[model samples]
Target: MFLSMSFRLRTEVEALNMVEAMGAYSRHRTVSLLKPRGDGKGYRLVIAPAVSGQAIAFGYMKSLVELAQQKNLPICDQCRNYESKGGFVKHGTDTSGDLENLVRSCIVEDVTGFMIAKAEVRRTSAIQFSYMTPDIDSSDVAIDPQFHVRAAKPGEKPQPFQVESGTAIYVLGVALDIDKIGVVPDSNGKPKIVVANRAERVKTAIQAIAHLLEGLSFGAKKARYLPVYDVVGAVAAISHPVPFMVSPARISKDMDYVTKTVLRASNYVKLFSDAKETIKLFYMDKENVVGEVKAENIDITKADNVSELVLKIIEVIEKSLRD
Candidate 1:
């Protein structure tokens, strides 16, 4: 099974992901993209603050650690400690020459994948994350620096610093290959199910995603710069045998992302007639942000919140596994 998700995150005064610190100034990650001009004549470059995919993946792995513990699944010591300095997992040297043992020992490594330099072995992660960036089609994105001074002791000079904060309707896209969890390709490139409890691991992976979004868990510097955010809207799709991605949400003149995704998926389903019965789409439109949409060949269910949307999808996935 393949699962794809896209959601709009509205964060204000957030220093979620930071890059290198120049002197006393901490920089927030930013990216430049070409957007259509208002005059419809040409495209203009826009620089917007962003949260890196690595940072987001770390947050998801944290959730995976916690959930795996609760479900009594396998996890490595390095991941259990929630290490963030060098990398999320222990270095590949620790698990050299044995892909089965590496996956068998840690659920995070199995799902997120790892590379062993000395052994020349690499396992591609089953889950993928796109940078949390502002929607190119929207104009309601801005990032600014906030200045602060460290408190001074008696007769001591105060230290000043600057940190960048961003507020925008950010877009996040995530994809997970459910069939890859607890399964690894062997020496001869044949896929093998390494873990005995593959189904539970798959469910745990899905729940971890729900946990990440429900708690708004991804980001940094929450102690002082907690963001005021909301899941304005989202769309998710599940398809078997063939992968399908829903259109990402955007705040353009016409906010019909949900409709567009459904139409696109409908066309895809028609083209792949065998997958028509196995494909499903779910969406949540808070405050009626996404107006009515009409499509065919697939059913679009409206969920109350992130949890409900994920739960409904989980049901479908679980059923597919049984078949």
Candidate 2:
């Protein structure tokens, strides 16, 4: 069974990945839209699944180490030997390599790993996520204008240039699958446990996703704030394996669709309690978090008390686990 997570996204002037300058007419160069296909044309609406997955993985690994220390777990001195003159542990094992290093048998990089085998490179990733699909009216997308000022050198005035900025409102649907991925075969060709301490590793990752996204800026400029508003999720289990995608047209503040999705997921969980994975839908609206939902879960109560994004995410994750 494949566990899935669906979510929403709203961005403002956050150039995630920059494309080549469209036309360097003005001094300030313009970044293409999310798609960035041609000189000025590709009306990209969604954040690529690859980019989002990398971001999530990076944050998850980073937070895993920090959280481990907070919990008083013994961290390897070699792993923490980050300040040595050795260039990125030139005299040490790659800390980023999940299998090569260890934190109480927990891979710092979690389920993602790299190995060189018989002159052939092998890589593995357990958690997978999909591109965030947007729900905006295509006609509503238009090229907008923004200004950038070059730093003045010596006696030169700060050159001001006009770069084309894109303004878009999209409703995104994202999917996540947390199943165990490929395993490495050991001597005699038996699958060894390449992924160590999975439950703890995954828990840390989920915590990072919930708390770190707002504080850590993704995609483009960090100087300018990229707005992330009202992010939430609908997590549950699944019965029959089926590909699910939400229409972009339903990306409004309305919770009707979201409610139905949650109910469906709940039904699926009830029907398929023995299934290996669950279903998750992450929507970016608070209006849907209604009706005794929080009242039913104590973890959610704590989340509500703190109003932290991480807690809110935990609420959804815990709900999914229970289902």
Question: What lDDT does each candidate get?
Answer: 0.84, 0.41
What are the per-residue Cα lDDT tens digits for candidate 2 across 1-323? 23344444444444433344444332212222354334566565542211344544444445545666776544454334433533112223342433433322433423444343443443454444433333343324434446767799998998776544444443333333343322345568775544444445445555544443444433344455344444443332222344343323243344444555555555555555655324444433453444343211111221221125345555555454456
Using alpha carbons, what is the TM-score of model 2? 0.56
Which lDDT tens digits does candidate 1 get at residues 120-178? 77789999999999987964677898999989999999989999899888889999999
Q: Using lDDT as the measure, which candidate wins?
A: 1
Give the top-scoring candidate (TM-score): 1
Please estimate how well model 1 matches the true structure, expressed as its whole-model Cα lDDT. 0.84
- The CA root-mean-square deviation of candidate 1, after full C-alpha superposition on the true structure, stands at 2.0
Global fold similarity of model 1 (TM-score):
0.93
If scored against the real structure, what TM-score would every candidate get? Answer: 0.93, 0.56
